[model samples]
Target: MFRKKSVLTFLKAQVAAFLGGITDYGVMILLTEIFKLHFTFSILISGTVGAIINFSINRFWVFKNQSNYSSHINSQLFKFALVVLGSISLKSFGTLIFQKLFQIDYRIGRLITDLFVSYGFNYPLIKYWVFRINEKQNAIQSN
Candidate 1:
């Protein structure tokens, strides 16, 4: 069983994910439908937009209680960018495979692939790498 605080943090992260994911999906659909962008390229654009939303919520709210977030802003942002790049790559690749192999619409493929990528890749990295600031490091900085 998870500790109370840990469970709460996870819940908050999920909330952040939901908000970000909605924006990401909306943008992708809009680009593909209205702008006639390819689904794969749309994913890249939308994922970047979503990452910004996710990062803001994660930094100021989701993971803030665990560490002194402000002290390592530069490092966190760099790491977050890396994670976002990876996540977008995975989503684009996975969605394409799902569409080809399963003969699904790109929308369905993307939704399915997102479930895996969001949980398997994005959240873990965001928790441990992106927003998991080092308390000792911040303490030293503060001194």
Candidate 2:
């Protein structure tokens, strides 16, 4: 299992992730209003932007691991893709359950959904999996 990273690194990654999410929201609004896209489709487009920015900045700067470029890219991409799927499922399910069962407006449920995705899920996953470095790898890079 991976352990905790430095406080400064963690804070930087989180800030970058939050900023990336804002960009995603901007794209979501633009696509939905300008392009007449559905919410789901707009979310997909926006999420891609957020994921790209988050991945690049976190991998290169926040985590700051040294590895074979291809392997690091592939591993981080795979983990990030999983995180995206999990976050989406949380959002979709929250809206579905709230609207269908409790008769809540999905728009309201979306605020709840966004909170969980950003704070609850993304940080822990990125800290542990997306930026994981093995013992041997760490030892090799220390010299």
Candidate 3:
């Protein structure tokens, strides 16, 4: 049962992430192609938008968090923002390094960085820290 639940949660989170990625990629393309913005600047703006969408879906649907209180939501959002900041830094630097060292295309570098960060960094932090179940609440429910 636990394994099943975990798998289901992971699947839901992935679907939510895919949806967010669409928003992020769309904004990045629009900014870069239409507005003539630098790719880095475009990524920054698009990543922020993606983070907002990701947080909403993860909190409400993937994690099944019931707390609607302002403080609870604010706290989760703050943690998620920090995670996003770290992820953006990782993605930016990783892309640069990959491009310079391996002569990979920037788009391919970004894709690689996204995969590494998503699996290695984002999943663990978001699961264990950002949207973690409240111990006290769980204890109460179990009792």
**Candidate achieving the largest lDDT:** 1
TM-score rank order = 3, 1, 2
Q: TM-score, each model?
A: 0.88, 0.78, 0.90
- Model 2 residue 30 lDDT score: 89
| lDDT of predicted model 2 | 0.76
lDDT of 2 by residue, 34-103 (tens): 8998656777778888788888788778777646679777888898899987876676677567767888
Q: What is candidate 3's TM-score against the reference? A: 0.90
Task: Show pairs that collide, candidate 1.
Answer: none
Best by TM-score: 3
lDDT by residue (tens digit), candidate 3, 1-143: 77998899999999888888778878877997899987677778888998989988998899877587899888888999999999888877887788899999767887888899888999899988998888786666447
lDDT leaderboard ranking: 1, 3, 2
Model 3 clashes, total count: 0
List the RMSD of every prediction in angstroms. 3.5, 3.4, 2.0
Q: Where is model 1 poorest over a 10-residue stretch in terms of lDDT? A: 63-72
Model 1, runs deviating above 4 Å? 65-71, 135-143
Q: Give the C-alpha miss distance for residue 32 in model 2, angstroms.
A: 1.6
Task: Please provide, for model 1 over 1-143, each residue's C-alpha lDDT reduced to its tens digit, 9 standing for 90 to 100.
Answer: 34986799899999999999999999999999999999999999999999899989988888773344565787888998999999999999999998888899999999999999989999898888776647775565347
